[model samples]
Target: MEGLALILLYLAIPGLLFSALQRFLAGKKKSSSTAKFPGPEQYPVVGRVHDLDRFGMWLKFKEWADKYGPIYQTRMLNQPFIIVSDEKIAEELLVKRGHIYSGRPQIRSLIKHKDGPAYSALMDRHDIWKTQRKWCHAAMAEAYKHHFYGHVEMEMKRYLGLLLLDPARFLDYTREYCGRVMSRLAWDEATQGKANGESADQTLHCMSVSGPITNTMTPLWYLPAFANPWYNFEVKRESEQRAWWLNNLRLAKDRYRRGELPNDTWAYRYFEQIQREGNETLEQAEDQEIFASCMIGFLNLVGVVTISGPLKFFLMAMGLHPEWQKKCQDEIDRVCGDEMPTMANFADLPTVRACLKETVRWRSGVPLGVPHQAERDDEYRGVHIEKGTIILACEWSINRVPEKYPDGDNFRPERYLEPGWPTYQEPLTRYPNFREGHSMHTFGWGRRTCLGQNIVDDEMFVFGAATLWAFNSGPKTCPRTGKVIPIDTTATNAHVILEPSPYQMEFKVRSPERGKKVLENYHSVLGKLKL
Candidate 1:
């Protein structure tokens, strides 16, 4: 009788907790039952996989958004995909339910690199991801306090010197500047004069486009390479690239071993932290090597690839809108005078900040923010989202939503200003000073937000303010016709990162004295940096 009583007690208490877990898991499954999930026509076998083959994923996704409204579901190679285009839906899924929406899709290309999948930013939520993110945040915060604006200013003014010399080669100039600064920050190595293809930035650009294309063919990743031409070629190519990057990573690691790399650099801190954990053991050594490889790719993604697209767009915005450009220059002149803008004085330059913010929103770089995965079965807005479904949080469509941003298509920074400016700010502007997803969704939201946002802000500010202070961007004249070269504001590059076309714009130095002063200041800053 006593034994029976004890069994009953145990079952009654512990079983209650078990039942509660069951109910919780049940709720997580079947997110939406009654609501209809909408999308374009899908074939029986291929589902909408052919859409990607026909047009870029982003372009087709945008096209479908118009037809199917904001929330839609489709399949790629028989895999479930949920695309969120509306701001409300994106916030609901990506922010409120970030825990279940933070997983990364299984992309073979991302994993094929020596330490590819180990890259915390691109990989799924794991212990390593959490650790790396913590380090990144701490590193950026420290950099923000000490070296943020001044370091980038050194790079930007140097970039301006190049721009002054050959404004027509803006493309190469931007690539080189981003490369040099990022190389210094990531590896503590100076690469200011590295040739175009040799710079780390150029390599990152080539790799950036690979992710999108490779993801679509993930269903074929494991088949024998001999059976697939594309697979064989990419594997060999990525292998070679990975080896080169890993060697570079080891060089940086060697510096750390010798106590040569700057202790302040994020990469250096990362290496030092792991080393302190007793990385002499075999497993720890392997982990260290993997992390070193991952960072090589991470720096490329966040440091170089992340900022280039919007940076080009920012310059294009200045060329297209000179009145706003003039106001920005006037504010910079009033606040900073002839001195270069530093992080210490950044608070005073709200106009430049707003302009930078607008550029991010206006021509958002990443349309579908690095696809995330759903970890569990869930329902939203009466629609079902199954476990392991791909989530494309569409930054492009959400930013363009007319309800939130009236006249959203235009580039207007005044919308970010407070109070009065009858023509530009407050009541006259829709969503005045509004900050969505941490000052526009360009950096993404929640767990996937940019690891390098501080760097992005500093780069945009230095480049924008420095250039506006020194030059006037206007339509270039056609040498043959002697007519103003028509600029195509709408022409853009392929999906993912939206880049402006090669538009005709002449950047004239504001004055010879100021131009000379800018170069002189650049030389002085570089000397102080010992570069």
Candidate 2:
């Protein structure tokens, strides 16, 4: 009798909750003025959750965009989402009227600390986000001016050496390159090894559990703590993440006290700034909040996995489209000439720049960008968007706009260089530059745009140029079949951040001289460091 009673109680809870949710949604639907917008047909309680794929939801979104025009609506349970594929709509809503559309959608799976203060800038809290953004901008600006180039160059050289040693491990080296550079910039050399790969695993794990399908299942959060798997997993990961952040923070602070860290490093700058401006001026005065916010905003959110996506795409592009690879190498040879390329040579290497731009457009890191929430009821094109409606600017669809990019499915660096393409411009020396507001929605839109764009651009540019200069990447030939090993450029991991499904390629040193130059630069940088 007790067992039956317990079973009945468990069943009754969800039934009662579902009834309440149905009533709430019915009221919302009656009041909603957004019915005029085209959308996929949604079921009663689940909304469109049944229609969406867990990992490949971005592809489904692109398909829906094609069927329903530029702007469309979908629901996940009681939450309404507005997906914008048109760049103009994105610009108008997310950029022009950013104040109304910059709030982050509340994902129940991501709510690890129910009662603790939100420490990530990714949260919806405006005041704390403002303070975090200001600190990030100031520190990044100072670092870029004084220290970022050296760190990137050092990492690029190390990356090249690692790739040359074991060409099959290019993907691993790409990840390591992004991780080490971010670690160095965030703290110092001492912390780079400890923070690089482990943080990446944590970030990816967090993203995996907090994706579209998991986010939509709001009922999971209402269950008892013992019965809730999502809540339990999130709690465990959050605790591990917090411990990692605190440990790194303690190490960095100890190093700072010893005068071992550079003044331009983000850790040094952040510590100095907080000490100068105490609790009265800051939103996050607690040490744990401060450390978590800095690390979460800078390293985990913007740095490692985000940068690795494009770099891997670039490598894939080289293997799949060797013609473009040769074009870029020829240009590098003409301009850089037997030396590894640097930011100083960026202006003269338009082909290299175009290839990098094309790679980003071809495979954006975040296909469906981080969702933004409407802060107030708003109207655009005679359509009403409610206060809490989630907004997604689908980067995958935006990049494939037929009118903007002809044959958008194919890899073509010439689109940015040729005369007639929509992306092209004159004055070859400066045309393909990312700094001139020519972004194709790669970073993001408006005030919420990534603060790490400058660093990302620099890293991509230098790494692309140096890699093209050092190695000739081509499709590997099978030993037995003798046929070319096929490259699947379309294959990607299904996380929110789109990473190429691991693939192999043949990376041969372009010339002995170039290989020697990479080795010399690696050793030279190593000698300069006291370690």
Candidate 3:
């Protein structure tokens, strides 16, 4: 009797009916929300979730922007989202009303609040965010400019020498250059002067690899199932790495305890500021917290924005259009003659700067700039956008708008040379590069705009100017095919920050004499800046 009853319950007809009924009811509830926020006209509970996979989200976004004007609403996984493609709408929602929208969507599985583990700064826009930003800003202030510049010049010469030695592996060479720059900025130590190649390579490898991996992971967490299991696991991994960095920082703190910590770049500045404020003791979490913040801030600018994205674009541009490379080198030759484009040349070399701007616009690594969520319910052109709606500013669309640019899609640098045309259709009132406008959506909008914008602009200038001055870049011919296949600039799509597709190109030194001249000039001017 007991066995028969167990079998009936295990394969119960009533149990199966109940399960089906529960699913049907849940589906009905989801279907009910679709009627209110109609997104692309979907069947019952299916909604527009499938459409995203069918048509790439960004491409679909482009189509939606065209059909529904600058601001439109959609639903994904039953979550209502707002897309704002127009710059004006972005300014109004993300900038003017930033208080409500500045908060980030929580991805709890990825951004766990652990006992002692430190998380990335970009993960939270809270009290620590303010503290970290303020400390970094003052640390890299005007006074330290010369101190850091002096170090940078030495590294620049070293980098130029390395590039000349091995013209191939320009990506690796550029990474090496950026690593040295960032290390100097962070610790006031030259990467080349470091004891062994092992430590330096470890640092470089971390910087290079972390960019794409984190970029990939941050977005993946939004997808269900895939990002769920790894939540605590990732937090533990991050904590372990943070522990290592904290140990190094603790040594610095210990040295400071004994009054032996030498004043240098960022660390020096931070300590000086703390001393000046007359606050000796810090929070228990200060060392670990600061290290984590600095790592994120530094990498957000140097590893991801400054180096990976722009360096890849610079390489691709040089690879695709070798003429631009020659033109830049020629300009360098004419402007500096035997001297390299240093801090002084930066002002004078309008063409080279223009070329950098062109590269940023021509192959913008950030296609759909970071999405801004509306803080409160808003109305735009009769469209009622509810709060929590994610808004996208069409950066790629803005760059490729035909009305704003004559040959919008072409990679021509000369358009900028025309009087009153350096910025294409961008209004003169707004910043043209990196952070643009009252509500420029590239760096981001309002208080959330990238904190490291200045650092990025400077680093990109250095990397671009240095590369164009030194080598020629483009595709290599396959002996069998005898056809020149250019680097694919269209390999950009968003995860968090869009990245260039992996492609091969050759880097060759134009002239050893010219390279020596640039190095000499770099050292001479760099010594004066002290930065």
Regions of candidate 1 where Cα sits further than 4 Å from its true position:
1-35, 51-56, 112-118, 192-214, 217-223, 227-229, 256-259, 275-287, 418-438, 526-531
In model 2, pairs of residues that clash are none
Among these predicted structures, which one has the highest TM-score?
2
Q: How much lDDT does each candidate structure score?
A: 0.66, 0.74, 0.55
Estimate, for each residue in 254-276, the C-alpha lDDT of model 1 and write its tens digit: 77777787765656766666657
**Model 3, stretches more than 4 Å misplaced?**
1-39, 42-46, 53-56, 113-125, 141-148, 189-229, 254-262, 279-304, 420-440, 479-482, 492-494, 515-531
Candidate 1 lDDT for residue 41: 75
| Candidate with better TM-score, 1 vs 3 | 1
Candidate 3 lDDT, 366-466, residue by residue in tens: 56666556666656555555565666676776666555545767887776655554344333222334433221345667766765555555666666777
In Å, residue 460's CA in model 1 sits off its true spot by: 0.9
**Over the full model, what C-alpha lDDT does candidate 1 score relative to the true structure?**
0.66
Which scores higher on lDDT, 1 or 3?
A: 1
Window of ten residues with lowest summed lDDT in model 1: 428-437
Residue 184 error, candidate 3, Å: 2.4
TM-score of 3: 0.75
RMSD of each: 11.6, 4.2, 8.0
Residues 135-163 of candidate 2 have per-residue lDDT tens digits of 67777776677538487887788788878
